[model samples]
Target: MVDADWKPSMGFIYGELRKATQEIKGALNDNENAYKPILDVIKEKSSKRLDTCLHMAAYILNPYYYYYDPLAKLDVEADDSIVEILGVLFPGDYELQNQIKMVELPMYKNKLEKFDRPIAIKACAVNNEKFDPANWWDSYGGSAPNLKRIAIRILSLTTSSSGCEIIWSIFEGVSNFKS
Candidate 1:
């Protein structure tokens, strides 16, 4: 059960997230030259939970980015680990419980560009059919053409950059499949 009135604030949630990050970082920092053993243990235990936390954080920070991650599935003892920290934000709800998808999407490396604007704006369209340029940019508060031009320009520049090779490759592959 989700709280309909729940509003997520970064400032309110940063402390908890940072604390978790710090716990990992601290463990790594304990032995600057040798973190393999510690990292292995952490990965064996909490990597899945950490990833779920990250995905949940993205969802909380931006409601439009609602996504369900299968790795969030909780074991009998999972709640005991995060109950104290996430309880404040997600009180009464069992977030760590979930079902895993038997099949998964193909993984492609991500671009380094700051696609923040599109990420926040298009989060709702994730994995949806209306994710194309024309459908996505159909709205305009006051100046639709100008916004469209800006988006096009930004996309063009980003694709031309080496950092966005992953994005270009994915687009190329997807487009080829359609044709």
Candidate 2:
């Protein structure tokens, strides 16, 4: 059963996602190569840094993305949303952010398929209760506004104290797999 708070308004999310997809598409079309690095940043965001944000948004939004019967097969509008949101939410962070320069999960580095909502949901499920979002934010080195928004959303979703538990759990879970 759907949770009581799970308002099924995928349309709103989908609209935002679709817009992001269009923006990415436009960028790619304009320069073709100048914006390639942007794709890299987006990939990083989807796989590790902001995977929960992308996954949850897609889970809530993609249901309403309308399409004609012919082109329905190539639907990645959800993924596109994740990338776009990252670009907007983190204007210069992608380029400024230091690369981990490690190797274990190739999926974290160059695999887009590993970034689906199913993966994100599963990751969250395995986290223990001790996980705290505020601590996670501190670890990830987030800014004040970014951290605050994340805390609010996570607490709102997990329905816990307006403290750090829910956000921490989510951060730790999602951080385990970064590409």
Task: Tell me each candidate's TM-score.
Answer: 0.20, 0.27
lDDT of each residue in 83-122, candidate 2, tens digit only = 4554556677764222211221112223223323353323
For model 1 the TM-score comes to 0.20
**Candidate lDDT (C-alpha), each:** 0.33, 0.38
Could you tell me how far off, in angstroms, the CA of residue 125 lies in candidate 2 after the best superposition?
Answer: 34
lDDT tens digits by residue: candidate 1, 105-179: 000001112222455354434433333322233332113233233323321221113435677899999889953
**Candidate 1 Cα deviation (angstroms), residue 143:** 18
Each model's total of backbone clashes: 0, 5
